[model samples]
Target: METKRFYQQRLDEWVEESRKQAYKGRVAEYIPGLAAAPQHALGIALWGTDGQFFQSGDTDLHFTMQSISKVFSLLLALMDSGEKSVFQKVGMEPTGDDFNSILKLELVDPGKPFNPFINAGAIVIASLIQGDGPDEKSERLLQFIRHLAHDNRLDYNEAVYESERETAHRNRSIAYYLKDNGVLEDDVEETLEVYFRQCSIVVNCKQLAHMALVLASDGVDPVTKQQVIPRRYVQIAKSFMVTCGMYNASGEFAIEVGLPAKSGVSGGILSVVPGKWGIGIIGPALNSKGNSVAGVQLLRHLSQDWDWSIF
Candidate 1:
């Protein structure tokens, strides 16, 4: 790995170059709160397992986790229900369709979700989380995230949560479909509440990087040297991050950046370079596939320049 000074200077220059990509995309507007984000803002934070940190551009800007939350929720579900049970409810394959598409749920027999990273699959994973009800489940998931980020202050953006709940008609339909297919064992509304709240958890780039660091270390907290999550579960989550985390663009990202990553509609991306660094990025402008345009470009630049790709 390069020195911190080297990364800092390159990141400073690269961020500005990447920010130019923002104009080619647009902020997500389906959720009213997300629509209010600054469209051109871009930021990145990288945390190394060796305790080096580098940040540049709009690193202080906060954003919700959105679909990135699905990665953790899937981990939690696996921890709660184990691999066999979780796989029974969701398949291991990625759907080439849009992240929220309901086409496969109807066309596929047995009706299990194609994978846990998509909205329908994540809703089913939310139901699998162990809790007394929606509130407990949401709280448990939140606490788990806080633990990963090592920031107990982490909490949901209530405005975003309410906005998502208000505008989640399609998600509701997906949940109902999953329930009808017997893939979801919990009440549809309650399960959705958990999913919505998880998606709304707010954090800046540095904090997001911290959370990614845990995953990069295979669920160990590098600072504390503690095994916070089981290694097997982390392996499973990272595999999904590779295969389905970028929605329909996973294969392109694999070839381009070659790191396991998860992207959110909020324009946040959590990515990990195995055994080295964990990265977090935020750029409000999104491509058609719902990934951060500037953020992806920035990662590609860094990966190519620094040879960070796992492949």
Candidate 2:
């Protein structure tokens, strides 16, 4: 009890300190909905392997998953199409460029995406998800996410979804390129609809932490103690999160925070402390590499203070 209390006290302090760092970054403006978010808002939620929970700051603030949805979509695609089929569409290496870069696709022969975490790879993964149509595919993925978070009522933020749909010209270009390369199996528009909807799934810090707990436990639902994702898929997902989840800053994040984590343009981060803890954070201000600036700083603080580094 004393230890929990002390940890909580320090966690609160860390959030306040980290909130000030939000000014150093900017909210994503390409998506009109995201641009309207509070530039300085910050929040965090942590769920321990043993069920302890700690949250502070803007815990109730809701935001889209953005790129963080790639993690779960990759897992779902792997489950739907199996390893061989999924790998045929995307490679396992990280591209050090921006997450939306298409230069590598043209540079690399056969045109497979370097990894599923990037925009191009995620579009392919979206097609790989088994469903009758875009709506079904999106619903199936959404159900999977809700199951992970143990929240049955979770749904999309339609405004953000529509905003992304209307303004995602670059994403459309990437999808069309994949279609031209024969890398995408589904209709380009259908696949992108599913992709955009998945990215717009709204979540708060507590729900994200709960979902991360399942991943932290290696695909086991922490509350029910049931296997939601196979252990092998979880291992693959974590590997990607560590190596490429933070876009171009992944290397620096590994050295500093030393945890497997995925960050979204909505200023959300879902992180794992191996078998010990699951963490979720949101700070709309993004650094140059498109990660939540204050959220990264907060993770660095907690990881250093508690020696949470896996490496």
lDDT of 2: 0.94
Q: How close is candidate 2 to the true structure, as a TM-score?
A: 0.99
Q: Pick the candidate with the highest TM-score.
A: 2
Which portions of model 1 miss their true places by more than 4 Å? none
| Cα lDDT tens digits for candidate 2, 124-160 | 9999999999999999999999999889988999999
Prediction-by-prediction clash tally: 0, 0
Residues 140-220, model 1: lDDT tens digits:
999999988989989999999999999999999999988887888789899999999999999999999999999999999
Clashing pairs in 2: none
Q: lDDT (CA) for every model shown?
A: 0.94, 0.94
TM-score for each predicted model, relative to the true structure = 0.98, 0.99
